[model samples]
Target: MFKPLIKKIAIRIKFLRSLSVNHWRYLFRNLNLKELNIILVSLGLAATAGLFLSVYDYWALRTPAPAEGGSYAEGLVGEPRYLNPVLASANEVDRDLTTLIFSGLVKHDESGRIIPDLAERYEIKGNGKTYEFTLRSGLSWPDKTPFTPDDVIFTINLIKDPKFQSPLRNSWQGVKVEKIDNRRLAMKLPVEYEPFLENAAVGILPQHLWANIQPQNFLLTQLNLKPVGLGQYQLAKITKNASGSVRSMEFSPNPRYHEKANIARLTLRFYDNQESVLGAYKRREIDGFSLSSPLEKEELARSRSVKFYDIKLPRYFAVFFNQTASESLKETEVRRALAHAVDRASIIEEILKGEGEIQNGPFSFNLLDIGDPETIYEFNVEKARNILEKDDWKIGDDGLRQKKIKGKNIKLEFVLTTTDWPELTRVAASVQKNWEDIGVKVNLDIVPVNAVQTQTIRPRQYEALLFGEVLGLNPDPFSFWHSTQRKDPGLNLALYNNKKADGLLESARQESNLPTRIKEYGQFQEILMKEIPAVFLYSPNYTYAVSKKVKGVAVTAINTPSQRFENINKWHIATKRVKK
Candidate 1:
């Protein structure tokens, strides 16, 4: 049997080797239908198996990677005034531009954690009073100029100088900077402030470019618009209108940057308002833009080309009652009644379009990891009325509550001042109606966005101010709630003064241990809630709208809107396949 099989196989091999195209075709033509069908099925199966192997090999070995070419255009609401980091604190546009064009010794990552940027590493010394930083090796500016510790020293000195009038001056008041060597420097604070790292995130200016400029001429210099620094991107061009107003600015990736960005070009277009920015986005003139108000969300979401990223920010908007501006608000029960009467959930739903979280205290629960107080001022109209009645506050003939204190008749009426922005105005109206529902008269004082700070906040002219406070990543409540920060230029909007609260804030600032600091903040919040200095409302989400073409935006939480670009270098508009 083996001999017969071998002889058959040999004969078949010889016959196949001798066969040609015409012979095979003739042979197939003579075969039966069943044999022909079997041959066709075998060929089809072999081809399918080959294709499956090819695809499996491809997918198993390749991955998608960010490619280094593409352009991105963003629409901003304001024109760039001063691109210098020291003076950019006042203008959002300036802050956004400076963030890309400048680099600091240290920077915050997408998670709001402090990371080294220009500095290679840092250490705390002198019992946490001194922070010593070592600069990264071989760092250079866009113009190929070497960067050193002197640049950091110069930037801090400018911020400390009163003539510069930098908004950052207050933070660096008691800090002293010393250059230890060409690549190392140290900053010594008056006290061991745990939040000093946040302050160190300020952008560093090129001393060689700014040293010759006088303080008076600082705002007029051309360098403000065309800056040179050690950031990921550098200014490439600026477009202006006939009126000499900047209409658009373009930036190119800095080759000298530590890590090159994937996007080759970045363009920012300026508009007078959010409407114009939205219009430009709808017209496809810009690839991405941020929303200033939640009202535009529905309209913008209708577009299929864009996506919305709702980022949680460490901020809160509240109604701060000035005890000195109104006599009725001086009483703790009166303040508690006002806080209880106002419906925070309704305001967030109607005014914010359900885009915000109802805040109960000054601190953010998500950011600080602290539990809410057991007794929150829940929305209860009857309860608010009962509290006022118990405190000797009676409803007068005008349908408003009044109380006689120290032989003086004080009506429970006060003005609620806020910016004329549509959202804030609506919030103020809703709050006013809520208070009025509980027999408390509330007057709405809507002022322009520019005048609200200088005219209303600085002078403490309003009895109650509806404003927002943006806290840093560390959430230091000292500046917003401390007694020392009550005067002009101070952020203590309620003019709140409590010795125990002040001690808690001061101690919290100096405490580096996370658990201890959190405990101190919890105590401070309890005191604030008991005193009722401010009626905490809600924390709104920072909505960033971008085209679906852009990818790699992983930031979920940010201290400020500008910090959304913390990982900008990783964002890309172009992609390529590479080995996994």
Candidate 2:
């Protein structure tokens, strides 16, 4: 019987190699499932081997499976749309892989202070626009090319090129890049200079290998999917689908990383959607990932065999209404009325399933951290109606809102573009219902994650948009809610043009002294809170479920913008085996 079981296992192992890529995907995907099913079948066979199969109660079978590596096997959000850090946005999956593949001049600390990474020290000119940085010696790319100032210069040039559509243009556009020496690079900024010292947070790319790729179309370049990395991971194998298209991302530890690679290898398996993503996790098909569902959180938290984490992070998914739309939302009274109508409290409690806290003010969360939640506007249906009435938006015979605009009843309708974040989708539906309660029309359009960024939000093409954005801790209202950001390379999602908001934001940006900067940003927050340009929503917490064996788990306030694995090098598995 033992020999027969061994033969069966051997045949399965042999069959695994001959399988096509899709079957290979299925096997690796169900590795935990296959392994567990075999174990359970073996246990049942043993029970059958014993003659007394009394009542055959499945008590042990119903018991929870041991929380092991399988819980980690799911919800990784699939392979990144963009692998190159220079082209990537704030994608968690891409950023995690990029953290392995690239290193920046300065890295942020647990306290949000800028610390040295590739650069040992930096010097700023008196005006604060020109920054000169000196690199640390003895750094090498995975391909053994020497790290130099030329790479920095080339990267800066690449970002400045309009054809690259480089995502960093928003942050890097104001700067002129130049190599001071083989070991140094200097930059000239466009203005009084805020976010410069911090912009070192941008990952520096390896120009030696990527330079040959045409900047006009770098994102689609064959090299992007398998580029040489300067960070902690080196590409191991380029796996293709059955059709021979690229799919899985596999990398081994980079021998050239300045610090030791904590994990031996990193593999990100592809899944078409979140359902499959979660399924893989439930079956323990992958490791080291993020969670989206409330049930997943509850189950993972209770699993004593695995380490679970729920760190309160400072990321918010807010709705930005185009105030300039048809003069319906332009009325301060009507816009504020729409803002006041939505019951964020009930929406969060019901739709979000108690996953977040309502934002205190427009600029609080991780950026400013000052606002009275209670004093902030709450849902008051009567007040919302009164405000709308003052603006001549009256209740028609149909009980829906109508305006005698150009002698016609006009019902307000707007489109909202969003990524496929389900919580936001549900919240959007709820908000639409709430807005309908106030007699406004809302059309929700769920677009691809990158499509919303590339087409709608970045270009300011929608009447309204729903998305999550993290304001850096130090506060740069200039980049986000400011009027100047309406220009090209700005993050003014609302396309909001306000002289007062612009003045306040610029003042906040120009203030170099910490106290002065904080005071100005506080004032900016106050104005934004009053303006109600973008509906203040909840800041959702980031959840991490780790294995108990992993040690040194910690989190910072800005955990949502960056990965918990950003500092993963300092972490170690306590139960890790000593290799021979």
Best by lDDT: 1
Clash pairs (backbone) in predicted model 1:
none
* Clash count per candidate: 0, 4
TM-score of predicted model 1?
Answer: 0.90
Task: Write candidate 2's Cα lDDT for 6-64 as tens digits.
Answer: 45655654554476989756755676877968856855655553322222223322432
**Model 2 error, position 242 (Å):** 1.0
For model 1, how does the per-residue alpha-carbon lDDT over 534-580 read when each residue is reduced to its tens digit? Answer: 89998888899999999898888888888877578889999987878
- Our model 2 lands, by Cα RMSD against the true structure, at 14.8
Runs in model 2 with CA error above 4 Å?
A: 1-75, 90-92, 125-127, 220-222, 367-375, 412-420, 441-450, 487-489, 559-562, 574-580
TM-score winner:
1
